[model samples]
Structure formats: structure tokens, C-alpha cells
Target chain A: MAESTKKKKKGGRKKSDAEMEVKAEEASEQADVSEETTDQEAIAAESAGDETTDEGDNQVAAPKRPDPDWQKAEKPDLSLDERLQGLEEDQLRQMMKDMLLARRFEEKAAEAYALGKIGGFCHLYIGQEAVVTGAVHAQTPDDYVMTAYREHAHALQVGMEPGVVMAELFGKETGCSRGKGGSMHMFDKERNYLGGHGIVGGQVPLALGVAWAIKYRKEERVMQVYMGEAAVNQGAFHESLNMAALWGLPVVFIVENNRFGMGTAWERASSLYDISQKSKAYAMPGRVADGMDVLDMYRVTKEAVDRAREDSGPTLIEARTYRFVGHSMSDPVHGVYRTKEDVEEHKEQKDPIRLFADVLDEAGIVSQEELEEMDDEAKRISAESVEFADEAPDPEPSALYEDVYANEDVNGRLYFDGRERP
Target chain B: MAEITYREALNQALAEEMERDPDVFLMGEEVGVYNGAYKVSKGLLDRFGEMRVVDTPITELGFTGLGVGSAMVGLRPVIEFMTYNFSILAFDQVVNSAAKLLSMSGGQFPIPITFRGPTGAALQLSAQHSQALEAMYAHFPGIKVVVPGTPADAKGLLKTSIRDDDPVAFFEGEMLYNIKGEVPEDEDFTIPLGVAEVKNEGSDVSIITHGKMVHVALQAAGKLAEDEVSAEVLDLRCLRPLDTDAILATVAKTNRVVILEEGWPYGGISTTLTTLIQEEAFDHLDAPILRVTQADVPMPYAKGLEKLAKPSVERVVEQVNKVLYR
Candidate 1:
């Protein structure tokens, strides 16, 4: 059985002409060489017994696989134009702007992190913009959104001001978390964005609680939680899924399958490559979306959100996506586990922003000049946010004692360390 | 006031709070249909229905996080851990999510959630089930830790915990559940957290404690009275918002102190009180503070070893006598 033929059968769609052009551009010899390199590296690294105790060891090699195989895994049909139907021109333009804004914001964040303006583990959402933006497009402002540490894009998508998000990175009082919660914890209660929880799969159960509240209150709201593919291995993920399905709660579980959990590939870390299939154990409908295509992501997420709001129960969506950057600011873009060629191919062929822009252009929904203007506008907003964060005041030293308890007056002495309060 | 068991007091508090506020709901293992593992939620399912009194699968971490999440969204959720030992399974959600959510979110969300469960040794339930976890919980800054030793305190403190806009870790005494005491009849009867009560007043020495240890301290105080050495018994109902003024007052009055706790001596609440007394009221103390704590080892299953492991009235009395320089 040929691998390409198998993928075609599972995809259930013939390749579009544009896809064929990109495929023809990739030399077959280059793919073969990268496959050989991956196998040799995996075997050599395994035999050497190279184990690292370093916490920043994002260079660990994943289990060997032919480089092209995981890339050709099944995805939604590529007729992104179909997804543009029933949407007004303004909505499509907003979606484009939102994705661009996320990309531009992260680019600025990466720059700030390099200049020592941001501290702590800053995980940028550079390449995975479409996944969150499209999912947000499917949600109402009243609906809740929660995700793991890689959530700058999720914050922007859920309508958090870029200035506040940047200020959070800068640890300013004006940050969404009031300078207390740094890079990994972004929260906006008014926008219904729960937080940027740092722990892996930690936000899923919280999402379940929000969903349970919605069900208990007899409200027609949905709670959507996003996590990386690595979080699928967490016990909380399975436990949350079981309860969400058992109670028929209105929640959507989205696993942004960005191909890598830091350095380890999804295929290397997971026993089963197909993460959506795990949802079967929880008795929920498992759907997969082409995460790079914003329209397809919106379509699948909308269907799940509708089902949940109508009280049909939760849906588990495996949004097949890729991150164009390192796991965090400290890591390299591509090395150790993945080849530079592989990264380049994905960047050229499936860069979510570029792909969406092309779809918009081909469908006549957006002009090239309009897309350029949107990108420039996004850059301006992102650049100004940096200035805002740079000038934002630091939290007052008195703030150290504040917010430890909701009603500290009634709770009595909260700080026991004997630090004098000014 | 009405005579009731500690169990009944907790039940009354849950029922009254749920009845008072529609947002207040109870969730835990065997809480609804099974009427709770310790039957603390008995008749709540029938009274409030399954929606308010929820029965959940044994996913402690999941359900606990769910409760925190619900509390984040303005619902007052009372999550019952079958035992404080089992709460270790949900420790992350308690410490990481529930306790830290307020401070970490920069006070955006106030988690009005209560994690109540039977704590401390009950017969030969062994190490896993018989551990006291108040010290570990009280260590966190954002959470309020309460231990109600008597029926009245159980009803009053629990009502206050549910109403407070902070996450509260309410530790119920497993051995004191069936103990009877007088409880106020008022539905709104509530005790303020972070307040200490003098269970018995004296001036020779002070036996300071909380939770089940309060009874042991009182017993020791009675023994000291017989020996013509008066001892003050102070019960610190809440740990995080510690009654520092009350503790200091007791220290000043007694001039000697003996701290007691059911947890291990190393890093126990006793260690904290001793440090606090020496730091805040050093000149007032006549002798170094002593602590009566569980043996520095895991709880044993055998009767003799288990008895030896726990802090007893004899141990508390011995510590009091030592502090009094007898």
C-alpha cells in the first residue's frame, strides 16, 4: 500500500491544483535524504544513551519516521472557498485581521523577549494563529475560552487588548493579570477568557467546570478549552473528557495538534497517532479539522459549538496544525528532532496566514492591497502595544500584600512572613 | 441552641447555605445518592435535588478543578473530599488552581469554594487514610484553612467558609464526627474565620492547638488544673488568617506555651506557633515553647504503634508540665 494513496483514501478528496503545484515544487530526493537523516539520528542518539537532566532540553530527538509521513496525515478537504459561504465580507476580513494581529503581536513579543524586556518562560504563538482565531470566530463573546501556557494568540483572539497582553509580558500593572501573573497566566474575566494556565492539561477540568455551570444554570453558553497535542497524554485530559461526556456538558475540547510537544513529535509521544480517536473512549463525536485553513477550523468548531449550545453534549476536535517557531523563546526554530527543510516546507506551503490570504485572494473576498493594509495595521497595533508596555508602570510594592485574599479585612492577617506593610 | 453531633452541624451548614443562595451547590464522591462517604451530606440530595447536591465520579483532580472553575464563575461550590488523605489526589487543583487563582489572576476571580473532608486518624485506617493535612493546606497563602473541633464551631465556621469570597480548606475531625455538642439554631449563625477561642482559661501555661488537638489540649489543661498548674487552652479555628493577636495574648498571659497538633512535629503548625511566639512575644515567655505532635513517621496500622504515633492527652499534659517547669 502506497502511503500517498492511503492518505488520499482517508482524506476522501482529490488534491486541488494549488496543492499539486506545491507538491511538484518539493524534490522527491530531498524528502528521501531527510528521512534517512532522521532514522540515523534517532538510532545514534538512542545508542549513545544521551539523557539530559537540563530542564531546557528541547533538543531531544523524537522517534524516527519518514519526514513526509506525518506531514501527509489526513486533513479536512482543501476547498476552503466552501467555508467562506454564508459569511459576509466584513466577517472574513475581520478573521484575516485577527490572524494577522496574533502573528504581529507574537513577533513583537519575541523581539521584546530577546531585548530582556520580558521575563519568565515566554511561549509565543507565532505559527498557530489560525487555529485559535478560527475557533474564536465560532464562539460568541459570552462563551468562555481557556488554554495552556502557549496562549498569547488565544488572548488576542478572545478580544483582549494587545496592549494589555504585551503589558502582561512586560510584568506591568496595566497587564491583564495586573503584573502578578506573568507570561503563562493571562486572564480577563470581563471578556470571559478564563486564563493562560501554565500546567499541561490543567485548564481542561476548569473548562469542564465552566461547562457544568452553564448546564446547571440552564444557560445556552459553551466553554471551549484548547491544549497542545502533548496534553492529550495527561490524566486530567481523559478524566475531564469522561465527565464532560457522562454529564453531557456543553463544552468543546480542542487539541491543537501542532505536531510537536516541544522536541518530541506527536507520533513519538503518543501510542496512538490519531488523537481524535481517543475521544471515542469518552463517547463523544471526534472531529478533525485542517488547522492551517482558518475557514475549515471555523467550520468544525462552529459545528461543535452549536451541538454543545443545543445541549447535545461536548465534542473533541483534533485541529491538525503546526507551530512555525520553537516551543518557547529560548529554543531554536528547527533542530535535533525536525529538519530545517521540513520547517521550511511547512512555512512555505502551509503558513496559516499566507494560505488564508491566498484563499481570500483566489475567492475574490479580499484584495492583495487590502491584505497588505491589514498586515500593516496589525504591525502598527503590535508596535504600539510594545511602547505601551515599555512605559506602563510597575505594580506598587503595596500590591505585594493586596489580592492574596478576596476579603483580607475579614480573613485577618494574610501575610505571616512579618513583612512590614507600608 | 440545639444538641447535635459534629456531622449534623456540617450538614445543617451545607443545607442552610444552599438554601440561602441558589449559587451554592455541593459536589463530591457519594455526596448525592450515597449521601456522602461520611454521610455529612445526608438528605441534601433529597432536599436540594441532584443539581444542587451533585454526585460525582471518583475523579478528585477533575471534580476539584471543576469546583474551582465553577467558583470562578460566581457559583459557591462545596467540594467534599472523602478524606483529607484522598485530597492529596486533588492537591494540584487545590493548591495550584483554587488557592492561587485569585493571586495569580491578580484578584480577577474570587474562588468562593470550600474543600471539606474528614481529617486525622480514625482507628486503623492506616497511613494513607489516617493522615492529618491541615499544615500542608495552611501553607498556601491564598487559601483559608479552618478546623472546627466542636459541633458549634463546625456549623458556624462552615457557614462562614461558604459565604466568604475566598477559597477555604475546611478540615473536619474524623474522630470527632460523632461527638455531641450544642449548636446555635439560627440559620444565619456564623463564626468569623481567623479568630481563636479560649476553650478553657488559665494563667500558669498555655496549650495552644486546633482541630482534634483542641480536645486533647483541653484534657491536658484539666489535668494541669488538678496538679495546681493552670493552663490556657486556645483553639485557633482558622490557620491561614491566623489569630496572631489572640496567640500573642495567650502567650503574654501564660508566660509559657505548649503547642499541639496531630501532624508531624517537623514543619507542623506547632513549629509555626513556636516561631511566632518567640518572634512576637519573646520577652513574655518564661521557658522555651514545646510541641506535642504525632511521631515523625508515617501512621502505623497496628494498634500499639498507631497509638504511639499519635499525640495523646498524656503527651499534651507532659508537654504542658515541661513548659510550666514542673
Candidate 2:
């Protein structure tokens, strides 16, 4: 099967695509040679009467044949027009509008952080708008969504009011989490957006448990947990995947491979080149989607969601994407870990919002004037959200003691203790 | 009422809670098939089946966080750590996720999960295996730390901890599991948390303690009575909600007090109790409160050294003598 795929790739190469054919051939040959060498080493170790080393050696040793089941499925080669063929005009417009709204909202948040209006660890999701927008499109209101700290786009995409999110960023009483949780910890129970966890890979187990609860209740709702490529290295991630597969949980583990985890690039941090390959270890199907293409992401995630709803179990997805902005507002915009040229290249060519906008234009679903009108509308809404955040009251002083527990009397006794103790 | 071992009492509480609330479930290493490391969850898997009584892999952080997440979505999960020492592996989930989620999410989620396990020194279990971490858990605000002394208190407090609408760190004494005492037969009977009980009342020196050390305090009180010392043994059932009024009343009645705990002296529960006594009942105190604690060192493996490292009846008696000016 692998040989046929390689032959097909070679046969399809045009004379003008000579360089691409050479690169593909080189990659295939390199993989085959590495596998051959690993197998030879394992056999040599076995003949040497050192069976103790077999365990470690066998982990990297190549199998006798390529695993057709474990191999990643080929991504569709559909053109933008072909991919957008079946999508209704209204839904496509809505997707573009939501992406623009997320982009503009983060732009305003960045401006607020610069002005010191927002405080404490503001993680802007400027470059990753399409990933969440497409995922939200794939999910139902009954499904649960959770993510890492970079989650303003997720909250907004899940139908949280833009004003509430901005207010949360501003630390006002009217925020989604009532000002106690700032930018890193947005939660809305009504929407079933579980949380925006601060710790890396912290939400993996929670997503597993939520899926387990849904299963226990005999409900068809699925859980979607998002994390960065770097979080795939965490123990909790492996543990969660193991349990999710063991229990046949209804979950979709989405890894937004944004190329960088905080300041560290994925290449420097991960041992595995493709994060989706991790699913093979758990005996589950792994898929890779073009995260910059909203329709592709939606199509892939919607399939996984449907599979989970049918009690078919979990799926792991590695959404190949890039974050054009720095890791956070604290990171320099240029020339620290990443070069300015790289950022500019991604912004110009692979930006999700820009790519989606171009698709809309090619499809004639939206005109340039309509695009500008949507942009203006997004800007106006973002500006209004900022204004609302600015005028919203600071959390009342007594709020410091509230929400600590469900029982108010316990809070009172804890805060207003009459008994003096050293 | 029926006489039962503290281990049996804990098992009864788990069985009763699992029977009463369909939402309640138990999970831990060796809890289902192996019948628990200490047999505290013996026969529970048979009664509750595999779903409600689960045997998890050695992944502590994974299942602990799972319990926290399950509790958030309307389930009462009782997570067991084989020993409190093993719980250190899951401290991030316990502290950052379970304890702080309720407040961090602005009361949108309430974590009604109980992390229970055998704690403190148990015979020759070395430094890593033997640690009383009640005070460490009590230091956090959103978590309630419960340390039940007797079998009756164990069953009662375990039931209450399972039902409470907060994250609870129930540190059961390793040494007290086999100790037998009279426990109420009623399935609905429960003891409220944060309430101290007078295990043995007297008039001279007050011996304040909790967990397994309560047994030592009671034994020392019996010895002190022979010397006409009349020591009062006040068992603190819960550490976080330190029952200051009960502690102060005991101090006012007895005047001289000795705080005993089987934990490191530095920042131990005894230290907190001593400070509370001196601040609230200083005028009532006849002498400065003295604390009897484990030797400020890691528990050694040798039986003799382990005995020396923990709080014993002799040490409690000696502290009582000093507080009594004998």
C-alpha cells in the first residue's frame, strides 16, 4: 500500500514540479532506510543474547509491513471552489463574519493590553481564529468545549457575548466569570464551554471525564478538547488518550499545531514530527486537517463529532496551523525566538482569515464591498465591547469573599471571623 | 451501635454512600479487583460493579483530575490515593484544578470530590511512604481537610466528606485503621465536619490532638490521671475549620494545654492549634501551651527509629507533665 502511494506520487509529478518530486522521493527513501536500519539493529541485539535490550530496541524497530490502518488518511486535493461547492452561502458568510469578529476582538484586546486597560497574562488568539470558528461550527450546543489558556476566540466562537469576554479581559464585575477569572480562565456553563485552563495539558483529563460523564448518563453529546502541539508531550495527555481509548470515550482531541508552544518551537520541543502520529500508540484513528482552511477543518471535525455521537469512540486531530502573532503579549513581536520574515510570510500566504476571505470572494458569496462592510461591523462591535468593558464596574470589594464556596454562610464565617487568632 | 474496626467503618461509609447516591462512585489503584491495598474498600466492587467502583492504573494525576472534572458535571466522586504519599503525584490537579476551580470559575462549578487515603507513619514504611499531610492540605483555602480520630468519627466524617459541596482531603490515619470502636448502625447517621469532640474530659491539663495522635493523647490522659494530673483529651476531627471555640473552651476549662500531632513540628497542626490557643485563650491559660510533635525529620525504616520519629504516649505524657509544672 505504501509502495503504491509512493509510485502514484512519482507518476503524478509534472516536469515543472521536478523539485517537489525530488523532495518527496528523498523523504520516502529516508523513511525506508531508517526503518531497515532499526530492524537490523533489533535482530543484531537479539542474536547477541541481550534480550533485556529488546524492549527499548523494539519500540523504534520497524514492522515487517507498513500499517495501512495506522497510516494517516490522505488530505483531500479539492480546490477552494470545489471545497466550497456544497456549503450554503449564508453559512459561509456566517463563518467569515465570525472569523472577522474573533480577529477584530483580539486586535482590540491587544490594544487594551498595551494601554494597561487589561492586566495579567493576556494571551491573544489573533492568528488562530479559523481553528476555533470551524470547530464551533462542527459542535452542537449540547457538546462541551474546553481549551488551553489561549481561548478568547473559543469563548467568542461558542456564542459568549463579546462584551462579557472583553469585560473579563478588563477584570470587571460583568465579565463572563464575574471578574474573578481574567483572560486565561473564561467559563460559561450554559454554553457548556467547560473552561480555559491555564496549565498546559490540564484540560485533557477533564475532557476525558466529561466525555465519560456523558457516556455514563447515556447521552450522545461529545466533548472537544483543544491544546497546542507542545502539550502533547505532557503525561496527562498520554494518560488521557490511553483512558479515552480504553473506555471508548466520546471525545475529539484537537491539537492546534500552531508551530510554536509559547516561545519554544515544536521541532525543538517534540520528539515526534507529526503530533497526530500519537494516536497510533492509543490505537485510534488520527487525522490532519488544514487549519487555515475553515471548510476543511469543519468537515474533518464534523465527521469526528458524528462518529463520537454514534458511540464509535474518540478521534485525535492535528490541525496544521500557524500563529502569526507572538506567543503572548509579553513576547516580542519580532526577532527573539522567531524572525520577522517568517511571521510576515505566514501572514501573507497562510493566514486563516485571509485565506477564508479569498475563498468567499472566489465563490462570489461575498463581494469586496460586503467584506469591507463586515470588517467595519466587526470593528464597530469590538469597539463597543471595549467601551462597555471600560465603563463596567470594578468587582465590588465584598466580592473578594463571595464565590469561594456554594454556601454563603461558610464564606461569611471564613471572611468575617470574629474570633481573633494569632 | 456496633463495634467495628476503623477500616470497616470506612468501608461501611463508602458502601452506604454508594448505595444512597447513584452519582457517587469510587476509584483508585487496586480498589476494584484487588479489593484495595488496605482492604478499606473490600467487597465494594461486588456491590457497586465495575463502573461505580473502578480500579485505575498507576496514573494518579490522570484519575484525580478525572474525579475533579466528573464532580464539576454533577457527580460525587470519591477518589482514593493508596496512601497520602502517593497523592503528591497528583498535587497539581488537587490544588490547582479541584481546589481552585470553584472560585476561579466564579462559583459556576462546585467540586464535590473527596481525596481520601491512609496518612502518617505506619510501621516501617520509609520516608516517601510515611507522611501526615493534613496540615499541608489544610493550608489551601478552597479545600477542607478532615482527620478523623476514632472509628465512629471515621465512618461519620467519611460520609459527610463525600456529601459535602467542596473538595475534601480526608487523611485517614494509617495506624488507626485496625483499631475497633463503637459506630452508629444508622445508615443516615453523619457527623458534621469542623466540630471537635471531647474524647475524654478532665480538669487539669488539656491534651489537644487529632488523627492517630488522639489515641496517644487518650492513653497519656489515663496515665496522667493516675498521677492526679486530670488531663482532658480534646480530639480535633477536622483541621481546616479548626473549631476555635471548642479549642478555646477546652483551654479555659483545663488552663494548661499540650498540642500533640504525628507530623513535623514545623508548621504542623499543633503549631496552628498552639497559636490559636495563645491568641484566644491566653488569659485563661495557666501556663504557656507546649506542643508534642514527631521528631523534625523524615521517618526512618528501622522500627526503633520510626518509633522515635513519631509522637508516642510517653512523649504526650512528658509534654503534659511539663504543661502541669511537674
Candidate 3:
């Protein structure tokens, strides 16, 4: 917390609009807990069992492998020079602008949800924008992208129109999926954006098919798929990872460890909390990236994308990040599994947008006026999207039967209830 | 036209389609080097190379989703489950991902894929290995369900399923693979989905059936002919876009109706046909519609119990006689 305060004033910088927003959250990082503490507690819990009270005898009988040093995987102090490698000023500005747009868009969506404009489970991407924005920046326009339900940021990063995405959330005919797929499902085939899949870890296997097509068609492209850290426990995750590695498919599997999957924390849900280490069983390179640092996410993902494009194999990346908001709009941001102080600590210390903005300032890259102008542009775009969504028309009643089957013209009757065909 | 076994006909259809479209590829357990567990894909590995003919591990859910994903990007993937019973492991991908992706994505992605394999009871495959799941797939809307009973129907319908722009669940009878019939030699021959054919012309009762039961109904028709009762055997090639017009036409042709099925009677194609006939063709009926289905229970392993559990020609004959009021 002291380090963040010192770094905030390193350049003696003025408080921009975005920085003022983060100052409101007032979050801090907790003291690091060593892995040895967990092991000792587990050993103590085992000794409490009726069958084994003698700790010395149990330790001698069953020896365990030394725990991996996962702390080394984090790049908290990624140098400014490394961050600027191959990045132009314009590109850097665009990335920051895109991240701001995603934040403003989610805020507007939250407002719309409260006004009853958008319905259903409305999950917001208020935080964790760096994870998708950085990863997507490393991918080509032809490269495919897929992710779980928390994906408004992903769609925006892949160049989907903010207005169309807002229209989808409004369930308007002008939306991305013509109003069918709402918050959890966003698709733009024109952009090679597969979708915002709702099922946990369900998009992993589908990414394999995209990679397979890349190889079959002799294209130099990679399929990047993202999922929550909790999804690593699913059978689909393991099955897909095994197949992707076994076949040398061009796929990059990224797990965004936002600490919690809904109400359950990652530690309580996974026996071995190091998700990247699980890739060892599949004979693939597993790397860790600082999800809070946009450049770190970009650097790690670019390496994996290059490997996939070269047909070397697939890579597993565990991006360490956190969510400042709840799992969805209906849930409380804190108090069920996490405390208010903990959420505040993350907001103050590891806010991705603030951290990236600070980096731009430290490098003397973007001026205060430019940053303010970018923030204004983001707000304007989000406001315009809301207006467009509000004015957009709802799908016609006859539109319901459309897309049920592509060959509906040739196939038998889709409806058995004898509803008149449109 | 050339006579070929149902297994060979299926192989020919796959080869012809793969030859026609580079996007069409075959993937399954033991499909490449193993030549398929049932030998349905024999010699495809050497012919198409390893890329087009993929032999994946025994991961049904994984490979099925892979097929759906590939289809999302305009690749026509034909995923084979060694047997339809094994498809239970992949119901989530088949039912949720493949069947619902088009409608859920608002037609953004039309999954041009096919899942084909042997279905129904094969000797003493018993409870776990033997199952006719066409009704389970037909229950869904986005996917088309095809159950071809004859070798000629198998070739024509399989070619059509492979070329279909939407997801199709193609069920081939395990017991009918070796049954030889005159299959067309033309590569362009494809029977459109949701169409039915009258296997036998009769003036008395209409025996409505599909898959393996079509043969049973045909046999019962032959037996009924000796008793001066000419029964028509109608084979429903596809179940989802069901041949309702053909079904009602047969109902009008013969007032008496007998529905036959190899799977469980409750909440299946048999139940669906009974409801359809009564609802739409109720006025055409002279006698109460009788259905001959597998005894309602889990298929037992014992020979006597298995025979009793399955729909047989004798059972069909009895139902036809009752429908004929003989």
C-alpha cells in the first residue's frame, strides 16, 4: 500500500478523471501468505484424524514433493522498457482508450440494468479489463477468440461495435445476435469472434476445432480461449487440454484467476491452487502473467501465440487477477466470501486501469490532457450506445422461428404446436 | 445401381462426400488407423491421410464439441460415435452445444456437422451397449434426426446428412449393417431429410415404423399377406422434420394403423406417432391405433429376456391383426 502511494506520486502527477475514479475504491493488497503455512495446516489437519495422531510417523511414512515456487511466476515490476517493446505511442493510446471504453460500457450497462432496460443475469466487467485487452491486442484479426460469460471486455477488445453489443443487451433486433444472445453470449463471425459462451469451461473444446481448421487449411493463426480459474476443475478443461497438446493444435488456453468463481474462492475450490502447474500433466508449457499489468498479459500471450502459429504446441496461461465487483449484478460485491476491506484493498492496489495509466504517465508517454480527452471519448461512446439501444426496435414475433435451423426451408416443420409459420 | 451391404453403403457415402468437399472430414475413436471399431471407416486413413481422417482418444464429449466448433468455422465435420450408447457421454455437446448453438447464436453460426454411428440392440449388447436414441435426439428442435433402416436408404440419407447445412443426428442400425440391398452407384444420389417411403404397398393396415422396426414391420406385412390382410410398411427416414404428410397419407390410405418401434414405448417416436395419428388422422382411423414397442423396461442380458424386451415380427403381426380387427 505504501509502495502504491509512493508510485502514485513518483511523477508528481495530477489526478486525472480515471485516477480519481480508482481513488474512490480505496483497496489495498494483503500481506503475502506463504505456501508452507498451507502445508503445515494440512499436515496438522491430518494429524487430528483418529487413525493418525503421531505427526513424525506420518511424515516419515508418506513423503511429498516440494511445492513449486509460484511466486516467481508473477512479474509485478515489469520494466518500462520491456513493456514498451514493439509498442508504438499510437498503439499504446488505442489500448488505453479501448480499456476505458470497456469500463464505461460496463458502467452504462449497470445503469441500464437498474433501469430495467437489460434483463437476465447481467455480469459486469468493471475490473479485470487488462486480462482480455492485453491478450486480444496480441492476436491478429483473423485469429479466433472465445471466453466464458464474463466477456463484455472480450467482445470490445476484438473490435465489436459498442452500439451493437449494447443493442444485444437491450434485446433489440439490431444487436449482435439479432437480440437472441444477450449478456453471456456475444458472437461476431465477421471478426472471427466465436462467442461469449455461458457455460463454464465449455468453450475450451470448441477452440480445438478452430485450431484444427487452422492446421487443416494451412493458415498461420491461433485460437485463444479464456475461462475462469475455477473452470480448471471441470472435465471439459482437462479433456480439451489433453487433446490440444496431444494433437499439437494451435490454441492458447488462458485462465483468468480472479480469486473467486461466484461466492467460492479459488483456494477453497481447487485442491492445488496453482492452475498453471496443472499443465505439466499434459506436456505443455504453462506460464503465469500479471493479469493486473496489461503489458505483462500482452507479452505472455504473444509468446504463446507465436508458439501456436509456429505449430510448436498449445500453451496454458494462468493470469493472476481479481474482480472489484460481484460475480454478477444480483450478487453483493463483498461480505459473502470476501470482506469489504479486501475488495477495497484490491481496488486501491491492483486496479488495472489505474496501474496502466500510471505506467503511461511514468514513461512521459501520454499527457494529462490526452488522458482526459480519451476518458471523455469513452464516456461519449458509451452514452451514444445507450441512446442507440434505447431507440432500437425489438425483434418481431415472427423472428422467433428464424435461425432454428439453417435448412428450415428444406427440413420438415420445426414447430409441432401448429403455430403459423412466418 | 449396385447391391452393397449397409456398412459398405455408409462407407461409400462418406468417401463420396469427402471426395467432393475438402471441408468434410471424418473424426472418431479408432476411426483412422484402427479402421473403425465396426470397420465402417476401413481404408479411409490411408486414403485421406491423418489430417482429414482423425483418430481421437476415447473422449466423446471433447471430440463432439471439437466437431461443433469446427463446424462453426465452416468445416463440415462428421463425428462417429462407435455406438449410439456411447453418445450418452456426449449428450451435453450434442444437445446443448451443437443443437442449440444456431438458435442461441441467432443464426450467426450454422453448425454443418453430422454425428453418425450404429444404434439399437446388437445381439446381446445388453443394457449399456445397446440403445436406440433417435427419439432422444428427435426431441430437440435445432438438430435433424435420421434413422435409416435399409442399405439403399442408409447410403442416400447419410450422404444427405453429411451435406446438410445444420446439425444432424444420423442413427444406423447395428443389426442392419450387413443386410445387402441395391444401392445407387451415382454419387449425387441423396434422399432429402424429413421424407418417408412406403417399403411395401398394401390396402388394409398402415404399419408405421423406422430404423430396425421397419424390417420387422415388413416381415409382419409378409405374414399378414397370407391371412388376406395386406399391410403397408412405411419407413420414416428422418424423425425431427418428420414426414407428417406421408404419415397422414398412409393413415388415409388404410384406416387401420399399427406403429412399431425397437426402443422403449413411453415418450418415444412410437408415442409421438400415436399422438400425431390420433390428432391429425383420427378421423381416417377405422380401428383404435395399436403400437408394438419393446417391452417397457431396461434391456436385459439374458437371451429369453432380451427377446421379450425387443420388438419382434411376431409382436408386429399381433398389433397389425388387432388393428385389422381380424
Give the per-residue lDDT of model 1 (tens digit) for B55-160. 8899999999999999989999999999989889888898889888888898899999999999999998888989999999988888999998999999999999
- Candidate fnat values, all: 0.77, 0.46, 0.71
lDDT digits (tens) for residues A1-422 of candidate 3: 23223433532332222343341221210112222345645676568763433223222112122223232244545467756656898888888998899999999999999899999998888778889989998889989999888988898899999999999999999999899989988899999999888778788888888888888898898999999998898888998999998999999999998878899877777765667757867877677787887887887787678778875479899998878899998989885798898789778877888888998998988878789999999999999999999999999998989898998766455567666766
Each candidate structure's count of clashing pairs: 0, 0, 4
Docking class for candidate 3: medium
Query: Runs in model 2 with CA error above 4 Å?
Result: A1-74, A79-82, A408-422
What value of lDDT does candidate 1 attain over all alpha carbons?
Answer: 0.86
| lDDT, candidate 2, at B68 | 87
Fraction of the native A-B contacts that model 2 recovers: 0.46
Write down the DockQ of candidate 2.
Answer: 0.49
Tens-place lDDT digits, model 2, residues A1-422: 23224433443321211232344553553465345544545676579765433223233323232122111223566666557747789989999999999999999999999999999998887777878888778889889999999999999988899999999999999999989899999999999988889899988988888887887778889999999888999999999999888888899999998777788777567645566667868877676777877887886787678778875488898887778777889887654777898778778877888888888888888989999999999999999999999999998877876677654333112322443432
Query: Could you give the TM-score of chain B for each candidate, in order?
Result: 0.99, 0.98, 0.99
Record all residue pairs in model 1 with backbone atoms less than 3 Å apart, i.e. clashing: none
Interface RMSD of each: 1.1, 2.2, 1.1
What 10-residue stretch in candidate 2 chain A is worst by lDDT?
A63-72
Question: What would the TM-scores of all predictions be?
Answer: 0.91, 0.90, 0.92
